[model samples]
Target: MASDGSPSRDTPEKQKRKKKQKQRVEDDEEGRSSDGAEVRLDDDDDDDADEEKRLEKFAEEDIQRLTAAGHAALQSGDNHAAVKHFRSAYSYASKLGTRRVSKTCALNLGAAYVEAGNAEKGLRVLQRQGSSGRVADLQFNLGTALEALADAMEFEEAVRSLLRAGESYSSSGNPTEAALALRDAGKVMLQCGRDSSEEILNVLTNSLELSMRITHSETRGRILNTLGLLFSQMSLSSEAVECFQQALPLLSGNTQTLAVVLQNLGATHNTLGEFQKALSYHKEAAQLYGSLGRRAAQGRCFSNLGFALMELAEIEEARESYTHSLLAFKDSVCEALGAIRLQMREPEKAVVHFQEALGLLSRCQDVSSSVQERLVNKLSEALQHKLILQQRKAVAQRRHSQRLPGAAMRRPDVLIGRREMMNSGGNTHDRNQVSTEFHSEEPEKEDYSNTLPEANRNLNNTHDETDTGQQVISSQPENGPGEPSVECGKQMNGTLPLVSGTVTPPPGRHKATPPQRTLKSRFCTVM
Candidate 1:
């Protein structure tokens, strides 16, 4: 009778009560029907004549007060007042309320609360009405509120709210709102990438479609930019270029927006290995930003140009660009970061960048828990990279230190390491099996031949034995290509380091450089 050894509460009376509760829940979810509030002509109870007449008189008076005052208060931006009067509406409507008035009043009241900076209260009121199509709008409001609270507290529930909003918005003939929600969701999905590119293209595509249809040119431009950004994520530079072009013209009077677009387009091109195009875009962006007095944007463009130059193997030019960007965006966290990273491609530099970003965000009075957490993660990644680099550096230094004394007496900077030999040694490769069919004996061409230039001839004739292992003479330039006819200057295999730099001790053994501070910024700019 009782699963917990308590008296059974499963009687018919209990069942009826439970059923009523369930129905109540369903009703609360679906909102109250105006039909129940309406007076039915079929229910003409003669005993209620006196009461009905009195009720009609009171309701008529109440409706007048509710209607006049509520409208006036709403116009005056007194949302709380508006809601108070709107709540009295049910008492005033003798024949019950119309669906349009009831639903619209509730929605408008909730919206007023939101506009008045009472999101939590608004959400509460909105959620009181179960499964109305307005849930989507409520969800959007909830997401914004949660994002605002993210700095002070964790709003992990924002995702569920966002999903609900998306569903409702999609179902309510407002595809644009749904698309926007999907765009937000895609950001989360893309960050989910581990090995391959994240599968956020579907969400982005939907956003792109809806955004394109928006009537506002500025908003339309932003959506087009979103497409460009999505394409950039996939390293599809050409497609990104097309999107950017469409957006740039639309965003044309807004200097700051235009500069940012150019900068993004420039960065995308660089990533795609299009240095020439990247250069032109960056230069234009930098100039525009400079004219607009937007130092941060100007500096960012400069840094992007440096990265492009670095890819082209123009080390000196890259360094100059980075230095300029750092100076221009001196107050900017990313600028300092760009400088540090350009110096050595060090993760420590990344840490500095993140820290700077965090600091800047804080200074702007926008410190949030999410920003702090992201910065912390970036710092951790930087530290790990720094540790790995330190380990590598220590190993190289140790080897160099051991050879310091013999430097004058032996070859310079020779690499020393114990190597393992697999199976029977003579560097055997099972030549016949690893190659295409070779003539059994048509005066078999020697593997080592005159085809290789004379520069390697001397190297082939020499060999050295070391305690570590048998050292073979390397018959090629250490930093040059192995191709026999390669231009010595060209270093055919591109084996040499792109930049020329002598390893020097770090500024200080335990210098505390700025840590990277990854703050959430302009994430919705493109979206």
Candidate 2:
């Protein structure tokens, strides 16, 4: 009876169907071999086939699910979860004898492992799948894994893999990926500290060509910026300038990247000796950095700006720029400010700044000893310069006090009389020649210390000089102890020749040159 009180429905129709089914099962079980053992029938064979198909369908579904989950995790930056999921998917796909699906799964798994920083495991998994051939994705992931595992010795292999991957990607019509792969190859070469060899140039050129075809402006800009940095490092200033300039407009929407491009342009122009262009670009970069609230970067920009300003002989503006830099970050700017003071012949002030820089540097971590030694040398030079200036000033003061007031009033007439005497010989000698001859005939015992005050005045008034006549102070290597000093009388285009060592004027000459100025190399830091 039914539980709901309905009439029972197990009639003859159901009984007949059950009997037929039982008969068929018994017949299938009745089949036997020669040893009288039961054998399977067609009906049982059909059932077993359906069950296998069902299990296979379930496995395929699981693979699809896991693969989707892996991709999602990878995109979300959950590398470990992506690796686990992809690994399971790859295992299932492998057992299912689906060669194409399994290859895809393997590539995904390998990429996930690489992103997780397990490059060794990624490499093993990728290699285990056999030859990748012309498969772009497979080749790219393989290259990435190889590069991640590369050391100094294996860099060549990594570069080769990346180049191959780039070619494969290009052939597959993926210009963006191709450009990225080539750029990676270039970076690997740079990391190995390779010279600007033909191979490196070719790789970077190919990357630039590929990047040109990309529609994404920021990506292209970034690639150009990277190439510019590489060229700059290799001393290819012209090429670097071109690359940075091209990247500038493309990166405008991104302030940080735009600032970097501007800064790089400024540095490259500075290297090319285009101070005007450098000044403009550095000013723009500094402004951008200020807007971004990046004090360190802003300070560096201001420092570079000060360098350009100094080159333009804008002494006051340069000093102001250095002051801004010092306010932004106190350490590195101290050294630069000290260099400026030294150039201005304010050695006392230079000494103080250099000492402060040295003290700050000592407190910094991971600072190289050579840097500190350089600072020490600069400090020593500043102190020596200060002492020399003081001694010269004292001697000039004493001689000034000893001289009669009427002697200064009569000096110009005495010089004119000597020039007239020289001209009386009917040889129209210039004033310079007359002065030279007059001094040559003077008594050898006569003291030439009378010209010291004039020379001192020239040194003090150097800041008023024009760009064409101004001295450039840098941080370049000083002359050796035995090197001959530059002659101050050898002027070019109304500009005093650069002095490479101590200045020593000829007797009775009032003209003097400023102290030797060094040339420091400036480099732009890539962010």
Candidate 3:
């Protein structure tokens, strides 16, 4: 202070100048503090903007990854893994702020929950999502899940679940399922004293129109085929035929579906009693099934065709067709029976087919007592036919044995005593092999011309010599009244029995009567 009084090193002017400089330094420090605060605030705002963009990018990537994982898990048939990813996706979408993404994730999560047997949780999630907006697919799945759990619910509630399921499926691009659901609905609705045809038609129409919007030909064909079946059941044959035809054109490109359509067409034709046309359709169906590599389906088609042909009196053809069917449908007794019926034309083979069919049908515990009765009756009839055929063959063989060149007199195939001999009550000749033939010899070398009875030589060749197991078809002296003038040589070539024979059948033998039309077989819905 004393030095400053004299302004030690300076006067008052120097001291004032130092104070002013100090004040200037203080002011600059204050300005720096304010400017630094403003700059820092601006920088913080820029960082926040950049961080928001990066968060959005990260959120999008998370969603995409979650979706991919969920889909992969589904493809691997791991429902639990899919559920985890779906849940993660839901959480990520919620945080990321996209309502659409969040809803879809929740829907997938619900489906996974259902697949995991967590039905209640899935229902809650789905209901919540549905309340917020609409997702036809999600609703359909939930309703279907609910329907499958009907046993756990009240009867009324279970029925309602089915009803809802039908509605949901209809709106979800699943027309076939929708129609089936509708059919079930109709059955249920009938219990309430209501006809569901009108309602069913409405659903059916909508389903058809909706199916046209999709690109999956298989799905569309299935829907169309289902509609055809449904309509057929309703007795709308024409409509059903149209639907099946529509499906046919589309399904022709797919072997499996084409076979199905052909089968449906055959069924419709059969219902209309267009037997020939039905056989044609069924034959085509069988071929189509073969092309599609379905042995069972081919067998079924052939069986149906055989049944149709039999009714049309094409027994020989029916037998061949049934034989073809039996080769493929080895497990089905019905198919075996069909083959047996075919063999009915050649009664010799009937017994074998009938016995095989009976053995198989016996194994099926689900077979109804009525079906068993029918099978037994058919088997009995086939056995009876076999017996008659055996008896006829035996009688014919005995007569043939008697007719040879120098054999003893027994029954003659050609009854000379009667244009109507007392044949009606006559018994068949007993088979006798007491080889008795008289041969004439030459007289003192003045031999007769050598015309060694050709018939005798042939008989000798048949009865005694050949090492080969070749069969002999000799003249069975029974060529009917208008016998052809062929010699014994052509007799080796067996001729078909003449239907216009005046040859009377034996007393108790069943004759070839016309086909017996069934009076009242149990009726089917014929759908």
Candidate 4:
């Protein structure tokens, strides 16, 4: 008896019909296999055969015409037209009940959909065809579609699709294709940066071993580059450098690819503090990019070159390189200029450069918060420097006034007059009174020993009283040996904090100025 109030016989009859339908579907799928095997059927299969024959009679010609049109449209880059034709062809093949033709049409239709940027539809079509165990090409096409989808940011599904492709290719005895799919899957794993490190390593190891056995240099080079990037992410810089270098010769025929390897090598060397080697590689890359007429790429190379030069303390050359980079593209070079000027102790100039950098950032549509924060911090540092300079200037002026000699000491007449007034005293009490009056009338000399300490203490107190923004520039003295002493911030226990970063002018000092060039000639050279 059935759970519903229906007859049990009806349920049994329905199950029998479902069983027949299942068997027919199984037969159709088996017939679709690329390996041609004889079809087996039940005793009552004549009706099924007759039905399939009639469907084929009506749909066969239509499928052929539609498939041809689809191919033609795809070849001509009419992806929409190609998709339409392929869909019609697949529909006809499905109606005809020709399983092999239907599967082929499905593959073509999916590829067309993918070409038309309808990755979702393409994935669906390929998934439907790929459930059958022996469709290696279908799996391969699915992997291609998945990679395209991944390019469109469908990452998770792309990983699964590539893994399926790798498995399918391996089963079909194509090690190279299998390795290629696995390699791409490993790349996605790296990009995801999930906790699948062991799985990614296994995929990459398998791909690498298989790739080594193949004679495809381009593929091997690409694999090596991927490995290099992976190592870079892992902070294994030496190994990354080796991999990038090994990939270089293999990729030499491809200019764009070779330039990328060169740039990567340059960046890796820069990270390792090998500035000279980095400079050489960056210069070569810049030349290559120039030859290719890729302005943005050339600008990037110039910017990298500037970074290496700045690390080497070649500030002037770095500044020039940064200027060239700016002409090509606006970037972080203005901030770099601020840092350079700050290092040179030119606070006013640094402040100007920082303001320029901040203004540039304000105009950008996609400014990152971290970059803005860094620039703001830099500006704060510059302002603090300016304050320190002002404080030091005041202290210097006070020291200058204390050091100046009175003209009375230099004049013989004034000295003689003072001596006569003391010598020609009327009495002992009168002489003592006269000396006391002279001493009281003259200005008392300040004890200069405590001057530096008092100035530094005042400066420190002022700094401490300022807001959080001023604290970005450290006012605390460095405790380490060989650390450069900061003005107004050095240890001031008993000994005075030495006021540094200033040169005392010699007696009768005159500033030496360089000859200036005309604006027209300088502009011409810069241009």
* Clashing pairs counted in every model: 11, 2, 1, 0
lDDT of 1 by residue, 301-340 (tens): 6777777777788889888877666554443446335335
Error in Å for residue 290 of model 4: 0.4
**Candidate 3 vs candidate 4: which has greater lDDT?**
4
Candidate 2 regions with alpha-carbon error over 4 angstroms: 1-54, 193-196, 330-527
- Model 3, which residues run further than 4 Å from truth? 1-39, 115-119, 132-134, 151-195, 212-218, 331-527
| Tens-digit per-residue lDDT, 97-156, candidate 3 | 877777777777776776666767776777687543334445344554454344434223
Q: Give the root-mean-square deviation of each candidate in angstroms.
A: 28.2, 28.0, 29.8, 29.8
The alpha-carbon lDDT assigned to residue 458 of candidate 3 equals 28
TM-scores for all predictions: 0.42, 0.54, 0.49, 0.47
**Once model 2 is optimally superposed onto the true structure by TM-score, how far is the C-alpha of residue 1 displaced, in angstroms?**
60
**What lDDT does candidate 4 reach at residue 422?**
54
Model 4, range 1-527, lDDT digits (tens) per residue? 67897766657889998887777778678766322233334423877888877866668877888888876665565779978988898887777676778778887788777777887788788888746533655665666577566563556666676777778777777766666667667666665555376787788667666656656786567556655655554555687688778878988987666766787677677767687998888888777655553433555567778877887889899987766655444434565566667667798998897788778767543233545565677688678767667656755765565456865444675556556755773444664554465457337532222211112222322123321101111111211111111222222222122222111111111223313211100000000
Write model 2 residue lDDT over 20-88, tens digit each, in one string.
777777766876333322334666778999998998898889988898887666556577997899889
Instruction: Evaluate model 4: give its TM-score.
Output: 0.47
Model 2 lowest lDDT segment of ten: 518-527
The TM-score-based order of candidates, best leading, equals 2, 3, 4, 1
- The candidate that achieves the highest lDDT relative to the unseen native structure: 2
